[model samples]
Target: MKCLPSSLLILAVFPLVVVAKRRRVPFMNCPSTKSSSGLGMVKQARSRIECSVICLNNPECLSASYCKSSDGYTCQLSQMFLAGGCSGLPANGDCTQTFVVYPCENGGTFFHENRTCHCVDGFIGDYCHRRYRDCQETPLGNVLYTIQPFRSDYTFQWKCGPFTSPYTRVSEYASVFNFNYTLTWEQMKQGITPHPGFYFTGPETLHQLTKQGVYDLFIRMIVLGKNSGYVIYKHFRVDSEAEGYACHWKSFTRYYEVPYNSDEYLDGLGALGDSTKSMKGARFGTFDNDVSECAGTHNFAWWYNPLGCTLVTFDPDGLNWPTNRTGTVEIEKIDHTLIGLRNVYWYVEDDLIL
Candidate 1:
């Protein structure tokens, strides 16, 4: 397992990358009314603009009411909008106003006119944060899914097509972890992996994304050396993990598999059911630490196979497909690997909704 020193240099050379700008959504304002109830947070604000800024910054604040009196101004933040915008009436011409903030997450469309979020397929919540894992779990009328495979570059663009009647998987790559944009070999050899770029989401970020709900992972390996131009696919379920960390994975099982191309179809990850599961359970290791015992040998950090170091992981070097199912022969020297979590649903037919 040789390391590409040049690939590591990419981290230092391109320290800065452009991030996609977030769409600015204006606050919905209502005049001459105070929140009668559902206030979860209260703070002192000198002006209504400050109250609106406070609501925008808070993750749990959905709406807020600003009240001006003789003494001072008070901002009451609510987790929800009571009675559409405000619950109370204006008493004696009191200066009270409510500002509604958009609560949609994960690229859900927010309608300013109605104060409602139209979630993309697979996400269901007041804020579209929860994700459905499969067709059986998704509700009807969700948009359909069709995978557009093998993208070489990385970007923060929303991959979902236009919303339609039928429910489906909205995006081909919902969340991606790219190994190419990580720290240099020198940094990694010292057991340091800094996730600074938009294209790369490190272990810590991955832990947060998968902690909430059931998720399926799609792994694609691009081989550049020995077996050049070979692409492989692996699919698996993320059962459980340790808090605040992503290494100690458990209860992993190979379920669904996606094909790379029409001519060659493979399910190489199915071999993880045996002793390989134990290998995955090993704590993550850096090159210097070598917790998995194979990280030093492979010149990469990963939850490596404890046994003889089987090639079955999202690690750049471990992106291999077995020539035989028994795991005897495998094509190695993979240059790049794309590991993505399925955050949306595949299409669910109306008849299957029972």
Candidate 2:
């Protein structure tokens, strides 16, 4: 038999693996409720499912109200959400019904009976758009909105896992962050490109630094199928705009320390920082754009270093924890991360961990 090339042989041995897209049921039936808002596009639909299909086709359509009239059935698409309680539908019973169309964020469960979203542990708000941190403060606009603030220190947890390629399409392996900010999938589709790793937007990160005084930054990273982990518990201060959303810290304290002396170990995050390597200035990188160098090669975004040695990452292959510093062994992969940030002056503990 003719010999096949090594590359072809390898391909034959292991067939190409394909990832399937996730199925999304975007709407749920609310038989007892109808939209209180004005009518939108009125169309003829055979059934409520057809009305849902019509609403699904229109990206701007938030909900669809189907009414049974003497002539026939009419499908009315509206941008207003189908909230709970009666909508004054003339008490016609099942003659009129509404379908709420939207995905709840952060692994929230939508209850069709009341049109309410029961959010995950760390998130709250109507659509679970806001973090539980919002419960800490009372807004100026409303007095009734005032809630009992958390009296003592608290912690919130969010878990991120590995996801396969293509990243743009929603999959079973995709990570849920917030509202439309679902990591890996929705972000790529919405023109936001980043690896399926934990990250905070530049604006959000900057907002946290706006509070004056020292802040305690705590990061806990656990390897999958392992008992041990790494933790960065220290105090830091941010010099806003000093770098591309990168800040400075007082000490590099961690549960597991790097080798005592190793030339390969440049800094905490390799050559990402400025010339001084004090983390004074650094820029983030994405797969499309290599602002920090080598980010494109990894097919992920981060404060990368051309020289390697990554301190923290949610990427399975990108978590280089510095065993390579002394040429002992390769850095292990990190699969889970929990981050907490708190201002020294303020008594609140904010969970900015993605």
Candidate 3:
């Protein structure tokens, strides 16, 4: 593991990335005295103009009605109008009134010039109804997990995806310990290994081991920038020192022989030995010796291979897993400086021991 250049002068200044302006949609007038159903009280406004502005900001508000009575001006916002049914009496006398609604689809309040929907956090689509991929399904359906918001107190806000939840206040830790971004194995052993609270094992109440006969867990981190990533050790368990774990990399070299018959002499031979040639009956283990050791060890262990474990990158679009590129993932000061990460999720895929 080589350290990044210490002289890597932190460029304090960088060009600001320009964001495109979003288009605003005009509000339509609804019939006076007629207010839609499902009118949840958002707030009180002094005038009709103030009422309309409130309705426009609320994505769920489909229409707003303003009424001028002896008491004063009153505004009412509704979510379900097309469903039909007026709540209040028709306006009359000097009580002049007006109503307005915006044309938005699938609970989307923000409209862009491109005619696309600016969905609320946790949703995306032309109508802003579809859940973001990360939130749609558990990373590994087979693995149990939990999701929580990652909070940072830096001066700048993290550029989390729209789907991510708002940051929550949390106790600050050492600068060297950050699970928000990708970390190397060495970094994990040093930083996170000491902090058990940051990660979660499956079913805290359940004492049973994973179906694979090992402890499987889930963790999240902040993705600093493009091409930058992290590696998590499998078969994680607490030890005197949080070290000695491996990634279950996929490779043919990892395949080895297992004895089909318990009575066979080859059963005593470890997978690494050449006892397979003379054995009359044997079965090849799905994974190599390293994987077996890591899985079987009572102490903390993990399966790791340079070839099979792929590095993934998280960008504004979404997760970008291993491509044709090959090399150890690199983290630069600029990587964290240029772009703030929103969040990253990892699912442990442990092989079932049959």
Candidate 4:
């Protein structure tokens, strides 16, 4: 035997080298676990890539099966290649479906069993490159109250939560009533104005009071995105005449400067200017004079006096009297307290009302 030429020897060695190099095929099915007639044996690998690396490094490994494990992945090195077909190995209860590991583009994971790429949370699209916002319920502001003489109202503002967008359709219902009457569900539905309920299109919204009464308000928000929105409820009370003052005269009096039966008096014993009196009336015994002096002497005095036949005269000097009659009348003032709200109810949807 004689040695071959250098060029021919190099060509022969190149084919052998090519045959020894490992081939990687994505989504190829293989035995998920170690079996007698399937993959020869199982060895631990840190990840799916490590499993493929294990097969590439082994001269006898014609194919590989990668299954997720607590430590990482279990690499089943097979001596046979099924060419993207299912393995005939007995199914292992603890093993995941087997397939060839491939690179997942854009921070995604290629699921060997499913042969699909799965993006992490907050990401979407074919390559997991697009960021997506999750839908959420908007938060409601504090309820504000407005009072009137015969009615009152309330208001609130709200907007979509973080990474969420408002939907077109929104619904609201309120159950309003007082101690004397209750606003029925049908009445509430009738109160919803402008058709199709409180549908809104915006990132933020303000809910104004259309009706006046003490009631509970329920708002249901529908949002579209990665998540569904939520329903919120609030209670409010409005009252008229919740505060004011009540007043009346305690005591009043009138006085005369001239003597009784004086000729200078026009309509009475004294001129109107010369006479002084309380707007209301004087207290008993506030003035001086005898009861007999007033009897039949003056008809106005006889009928107008609180004492009647026992009438008393005005102060003689017009400066002092039996009682302090120069002071202003004292009044008793008070504030009105609000009444407790009764029979409160909240309805999220029309059918929920009762």
- Which candidate should be chosen as best, given TM-score against the real structure? 1
- For model 1, residues 145-251, the per-residue Cα lDDT tens digits are 32221111211112222233221121111113344412333443222222321233334333433443334554444443332222222222222234213243324
* Residue 26, model 4: Cα distance from true site in angstroms: 3.7
- Each model's TM-score? 0.38, 0.35, 0.23, 0.18
Give per-residue lDDT, candidate 2, residue 64: 59
Note the clash tally of each candidate.
Answer: 7, 0, 10, 8
Clashing pairs in 2: none
User: For model 4, how many clashes?
Assistant: 8
| Cα error, candidate 1, residue 354 (Å) | 26
Worst 10-residue lDDT window for candidate 3 reads 5-14
Task: Candidate 1: list runs displaced more than 4 Å.
Answer: 1-200, 222-278, 305-308, 312-321, 325-328, 344-354
| TM-score (C-alpha) between model 3 and the true structure | 0.23
Estimate candidate 3's alpha-carbon lDDT, on a 0 to 1 scale: 0.29
Pull out the clashing pairs in model 4: 135-227, 252-281, 252-282, 253-277, 253-278, 254-277, 254-278, 255-276
Q: In model 3, how large is the Cα lDDT of residue 166?
A: 24
Candidate 4 is scored at a TM of 0.18
Index of the highest-lDDT prediction: 2
lDDT of 3 by residue, 1-354 (tens): 111121110110012211212223233333444333333664667755566556555555645565555677666665543322234634444332233222234566533222234544443433443332222222222222222211111111112223342211111122233444333334333222213223212111111121112332222222343333222223432222222221221111111224211111111111222333211121111122232332122122122222222122222222222211234333212122111111223233211111
User: Which portions of model 3 miss their true places by more than 4 Å?
Assistant: 1-25, 31-44, 53-63, 70-72, 76-342, 345-354
| Residue 182 alpha-carbon offset, candidate 3, angstroms | 29
Candidate with more favorable, higher TM-score: 2 or 4: 2
lDDT of 2 by residue, 1-354 (tens): 111111110000011221212222333344344432347788899876666556655655656567776789887776665543235543444334443443356677765433456666555555554443321231222122212123313222212222221111111112233223223322332223233543443322322432333555554444444443333424554333334445555555545444222233223453333344333334445555455444545445555543452444334333434333345544555444444454455444322111
Looking at model 4, report the run of 10 residues with the lowest lDDT sum.
6-15
